[model samples]
Target chain A: MTNQHQEPLSAMLDDELTNNELTQALDSIKDNQQSVQTFGRYALIGDVLRKEQELVSDDSFANSIQAAIADIELPMVDQLETENVASIAKHPKWYQRASQKVVQLSEHKLLKGSAQFAIAASVALVAVVGVSNMNPGQDKITSPVLNPVPLVQGLSPVSLSSDSFKEKPTANQVTQSRINALMADHNQQLRATDDKEELEKEDKKIEQ
Target chain B: MRILFLLITCFVYSTSAAATGTATATASTKVVAPESEQLQSKEQQVQSEPQPQSEAQPQQATTPNGEKINAAYWLKKLQEALTKSNFEAGIVTLKGEKTESYQWTHGFKVNDDGTEVEIERVSPLIGNGITAIRKNQTLSFFESNKEPYSISGVSIRNFIPAIFYKDFGDLVDSYQFVLVSKSQIAGRSAQLIRVESVTKEAYNFWVWIDVISGLPLRMAYIDEQGEVVEQVLMTHLSYLTEPNEEINKLFEIQLPQVANTAIAMNQQTNNWQLEYTPNGFELLKSDRHHVSINREVADYYLFSDGLVEYSVYVQRPIESFNSPLVLKDGGTSFVMVHADGFDVTVVGMLPTETAFKIAKSVKSK
Candidate 1:
């Protein structure tokens, strides 16, 4: 059904309406089912526009290819245009040559080539970084501290296990585990205490 | 004379109701004096009209007659602002040199049928850590590596302290609320209030509340020497007049089912007792369960003075570290002591000395 009050509904969603207009818009939208749906659609569109990053996944490589294709205006008579493009390829500038090449390549072939290049580049970069990280003479590097030190004083961070076990020669692994477990449980208990009380109140309400 | 007497009694009832701090009760009690049904209904409607107009309440009235507002009133206002205001804030938590940024959004909406809904979300600005989103009473935690789960709660216990969401009245016995001067925070004027421990058993909490919106602009934990141990600063805030588009979309999201299994079913009894808890500290809960991380069985007891809380664990003695090991992390102090046959550990946002004392007080009962 066509809604006569769609303008106010969208305006209310955009927060552009005055207080008096907002109340009037809300009052009208409440009675109309189509207007409510339109309001929801307007809100969803606004959210999509504002939080585009949050909604889209981290697939930038594919996005770049799609964006490149969008920038190239594909002709309606593609096969016929390709025949004409070959005949008119004389005296092309370097940039125009690159653009024409991109336009000539099919979309699938271009995507596959980009994907292969991205994978090979990432693999090469990983190899170089991994080799440097595995340097043999780096004696200063200890087993990367399994348990992150939660505390830091001024500049230096002192971990619970290392600081407390420095003087004692005994293996403090068990002690470290105990300390971590207790600390974790303490935080968990604090977080859950409020939930428990709320649950108990809900249970009481259900019982009553 | 009879009409005047009725008016006086009605005035007395209304004042007493206000003293009790219940607005609806005051409105209902005002109707008792009205003789005619029509007048009573109209009076009730007029009185209830102001209830929904909390936003229209003059901000200056918070500090009446140029007199400083009570700290508890500011805390109540903070709670109201956190729950009711439709705002998006960028908050950064500072602990030593480590800083973590978060995007916090809270919105309140009312449906056409008069049902109220609240949506609050906190997401880390950098990493894919836990993003907590609370829709009404169900709080859902979204993480990249784990399945999302939901729990029932009024607030998201993230960077903000849980005490801010709870009733400030519970802290009256333990904390001394002091109103400090106003300061500029995030370019907005803020009223500073300190919630200090009455018995010096916990770290003092200072909150700088935005004067206009009542939202917390900055909050810090100060030690005995008045050094800030850690702080959360609101970098910026956008207070919306109504629920924003993101908040409206959150209403449409179907949060995971409430994981009732997460709550401990039975309160397990422990064979240990703390002989020397702080003055206002009350036992919150005690249970015996395998520590989720290490799988070690330990008896645990939690104590809270409303503002801060501490957890005590009594586990079997282990011979790894020297006795009486203490560590301080930001505002949290961890104290562990190896007593005879058993070990006592106290973890909380209390001073190390207070935590040590509590850890030492754990005796077999």
Candidate 2:
């Protein structure tokens, strides 16, 4: 449900809310994600109205909030629908640019990490291996390179570390990736076979 | 009132390591006795031609004390004694610079109709190890964020000395076990057995078995460079032939409810026809699954010298790491290779050379 606090948020944004109502909204927003997001949106709305997105300078606060919400799943991007992405001619491309930027920024947390991107690129690797295997005389160097820029991958499950990732020697990287791929495959199969976790409940007959 | 917001990563179930608990046994470790035999006839037999089917399960060999026990009997007995004998051992696992200390206990009781199956527990004496309680077929893991659930298996956790679960005779295809040396381990009569690869060029393993109890006291995986890559050493040992009242009471226990889901059926494996596997090695399991991309299915094949198990993985094109890589961590080693768009890797408790050889042996057929 949409909050009825739009008026109160506007009042707070205008510095016109009563001390008591302002205190209540501030307190309530702390316990609710939607309310906090609403406050952020209200702040953004204030920025646009003041016609000073640069001067408002909520970037640091937004960054901290982004970090805090990094673990939470975000909404999907509807802006990248094929037609919109395919459009070569659209005047005042403000929406397209804004949506694309948002997608680039949030893809890490909202979608699976660069592993997802790697899968998309590696389909070409499949063709490369298949074609080369069939024809010994085929030019090995003719294989296409899908991902030239290696994406940053995190060690721990936090933010992708700021360090730039360099794709190692193609042979070595493929071999290591093969090891990881197989090990992960082994575990996934094992999990498929044995990984059901269920809660223990009372009043049910269970054999020892 | 002033507001104070505490931000915490509230994902309680992130770590899925089935609680690996370890405890140290109280028996003192003793000095190794002497070399019974090392580089020997076992390798010769592996290199020899046919007509050895009769001598395959040889049991004529005797220890210094005139006790008749060959590699097969000793290995089978070791597995049986571990599960049947009521005992506890303090274990220390070493891999490179890291060491983990833990204790493992096994016990059982007999009632009217059937014997109360062996009850076992492995707990780490230090650090946050998963504590596992095994009563009969149920293994329940108790650890943080891991909702207690039971799975039916001989071992819920991996650190059970590998030799305790395998048959050396079965390993005759990949490894040759010969009487190597006598080592006093855990203040007991310990016999060292050299398990060499049939290929002669791959990694070898040494096992120290308690002479009296017939239990494996220690296992060491030796690399081609003559360095100990990984090892599980028993520092203390104790065995109970007969159950006492206190032990019986302990056996009468309650365990977590087993999960209601269907047990994981074994997945199908790819029979990647590799030509050059060392003798004594057997195909343990095979499974095929997608790696990064579902369309690019990868083949995983497990090969075992009975005790030391390794997996050979093969997948093709679609961008993966390209160069040869070797990694050694804890008790496992990994070797990788990329060629002709096919990426292959071998991982197990073997030396880097052994894994490297295995990885290189993967032919497209």
Candidate 3:
């Protein structure tokens, strides 16, 4: 369950791994669903680390690659006909590889220039995904990630967030009923804004 | 060639979404208005609007400062276009994976005395005749149900955000507005205004207004990470000079029977008060409802900052043993916490931190 291979996946994305190591990492991503998903997550982490927020990522990309991998016995490294892989491989495009690594390195320099975002990758990642997958009693995972790095000012810290929580019935649905009662109150507020008379009443409250 | 391109694109973007936080917006939906029936479909959308109590106050049409293009100006334009103009627009609302298309029309009639009345109707483009109409404060429902009742409101409360119709100054303390960019939407030049929060970075709003009409063409709610969570885009827009005969006739159209119910008030108040609330957001109302003869009483307080709103509920702690809980759906956040012998739930589109803070703030009054 641990994301132990993220560093390797990170290196593989940068085209830095030796040929044998690259082959092994790609094979792991091809065979293991979790590895593929983790690689996808790492690629995203790399993008954030690189500060390339303009490029749009495709969510279905990993799934499509996984599905293709399940169907094809041959590895995808040789199937990249669109890329000049054969000639590049024959000529050892040393400058292309070096310049690309330099760009990735400069991405690190760009990240380094903003000391505020030095801890951006790990802290912000959990905040983004943790906000979506938040669950109670899971503070062990969500809380520790946010403790050290105080979020940017003007932004409040989310101590608790969950996608959905299934209440373990407590005192005959008292929790759920209270939640519904609040929404019912909100419904009244929604109606109040649309009613001119009620609005005047609110305006009077604000004036007072 | 397509597969080759797809494979390359896939590898290039697949893992990169996590880092950049920019996911491709789904393909833009296209709705073409048939030239003959766009506004002529008075049989559907063209009606009058909500209560006219506020319409009596008429300000100068445009300021003498030569059209100050600030947030206040655009908001004023939006309000004017909504209430002053007669038009039909095709609206598409996208929230998460849910998309709904609806037809909206507004018609205004000014009497000789100078007071204006409006008729408005909204019906989903695909449905079994679920339509809502507002004719001077009586919002009548026209569903297939045997009995239809009218509600007291200035306008139909759905389809459009409630904040758009209100004065923009109230929201000043909560959000700062900066005109962001100019783009084309619904075949019209659009100006985008970025409405980011002053206190919380959890959510923001982008409102795209039509430059000519000053009407909102599109609006979206984005999270702090620069991702649009919910949005509404107008597909077709047409302004009318005068109300058509059908819309004029709707002024006297028969409405469903009004419901007979007295407003009830529950007197029970929990020993609770909110410790902190964002500026300009005030308590609109407090209500107490007893589920079982006042034994399991829940107190509700609703708060709003003009355009954005959230609610707080306080009641006795549930038997379940757990820490604080937070959940999000679409643009809204729901938080639950245990405080001062009460289990509280704060629900609205506010950030989880704000909601949780409000939830835990309930204390003995």
Candidate 4:
């Protein structure tokens, strides 16, 4: 029923409606509460696109919207639909109520467009930072420097102190990095050796 | 009468250990008194005699006329206490200038089907550090923000040396056992047993076993000059009759499965050979693989003299460190030497001089 009046309602906000059409749109909006809300939303969208004001009103904007959604009287809507379905034989009240719920849920969240915009902004920022940090020349020089192994590493509580020593920039980065790598590998080798020993013992037990 | 009683007890405990599959009683028979051989069946009856479970029992048994008892007996008791007792201990490991505290707990529980479960844990007393837990044969490590990993081993090699869990007879070839004077630790009387290296190449290990509970109270690595290079002291110990509530809760925790894909025994013929190894030190394994931390290929060799083990790594010559760079943390010495065509590094709980000698001995085949 509102589809016939949808054009005049939009044209009225765009200032392209004739005098007669504007008066009819005002009358329809005054009669229908849904039309009044649609008109207010259209006007806000127009103002935002034209750079009239900020999109979010306050810090608790999302919170307030969530609270409003929570306060919606779901039971009252269910009771009204059941009563309508019992009396009227035209459209099924259950279908109408289900459609109304979907509309209300989407309208109250107001997340579709805003979430996309946030994601786009983050992606662009990451691109800028990543491009700034990339150094292809340094990577080529350092890739050939392989770590020398340290044979046994006893992973202990005191190992943290040695780890901190590696964080400091030394005159020989290559040597220091190699030593760190070897020391860590040494501890790993010890654990692996223990593992191998355990497996062999198990195998011997099976043989016995 | 006292000697007869001691002999009967040792015979019973050794046979029970063998029967329970805890420790092999192969060398145990050799260490027992000759008279214990005849008292084997008689000792089985003494098991029900409410075997002296008092704190004053061991001290009374070991003093004066008890001098005939060997260190192997005390070591056997130590192994039994470690595996069978339900106790919690506060441990502090002194290494170099640092001291790390840990909460050590062990529980031996028996299932309804006659199967036994051994749960042991060593967790740092302070900061978020690696916490080791051993359930049966699986030794697991739980670290902060990292996946807990499990390796197959009978004991958690933390403050306590791994040798303590194994057969003490294995060290008979390389080390001599000596019974020292009685010492007090944490208000409890302890029996000191000193294990000296035969060749004097490895550090001497001294352990003080709690006379009553048979648990280790203090263990130290003593140098040639009788100076303690590193030590693990039991700050306090609580001997429990059954697993505590915490250990019972831990019993229900399903540990991660032991990963079978750990660096397998990849025996490869290495081109480098160690020309001079200390007496009794034999190569345990050798392989050429990419190191876990730095994907660098290295010819690695692990050597052990039963009590102590060391690793040798030979890699392609890199930027050398002042010919031989030697560093020591407690009893462990890290020695890196620049060789003819390759760089060699020797790391283990051995003396610096010994480590350096081993590092320099690496020669190309």
TM-score of 4: 0.60
lDDT of 2: 0.52
| TM per candidate | 0.60, 0.52, 0.54, 0.60
Superposed on the true chain A, the predicted chain A of model 4 yields a TM-score of 0.29
DockQ of 4: 0.14
Residue A153, model 1: Cα distance from true site in angstroms: 24
Better of 3 and 4 by lDDT: 4
Candidate 2 runs further than 4 Å off: A1-208, B1-77, B112-114, B155-157, B161-163, B241-250, B256-272, B290-297, B316-320, B363-365
Highest-DockQ candidate:
1
True contacts kept of 4: 0.25
In candidate 3, residue B26 scores what lDDT? 7
Residue B131 accuracy (lDDT) in model 2: 75
Kindly provide the TM-score obtained by chain B of candidate 4 when compared with the true chain B: 0.81
Please give, for residues B181-216, the per-residue lDDT of candidate 3 as tens digits: 557664455668887777663478889976545668
Worst 10 residues of 3 chain A by lDDT: A110-119
lDDT of 2 at B363: 76
Query: Which sections of candidate 1 miss by over 4 Å?
Result: A1-171, A199-208, B1-69, B110-114, B262-266
Model 3, span A62-164: residue lDDT tens: 3543454233222222322223222322233432342333233223333322222222332333223322223344434422332334346774322212224
Count of backbone clashes, every candidate in sequence: 0, 45, 13, 4
Over the stretch A67-88, how does candidate 1's per-residue lDDT look in tens digits?
3333333342232233222222
Query: How many angstroms is residue B104 displaced in model 4 relative to the true structure, after the best TM-score fit?
Result: 0.9
Rank ordering of all candidates by TM-score, starting from the highest: 1, 4, 3, 2
lDDT by residue (tens digit), candidate 1, B85-155: 67788999986556889999887666688887888899999999888999888889999979998887888
Q: lDDT per prediction? A: 0.65, 0.52, 0.57, 0.64
Per-prediction DockQ comes to 0.28, 0.09, 0.14, 0.14
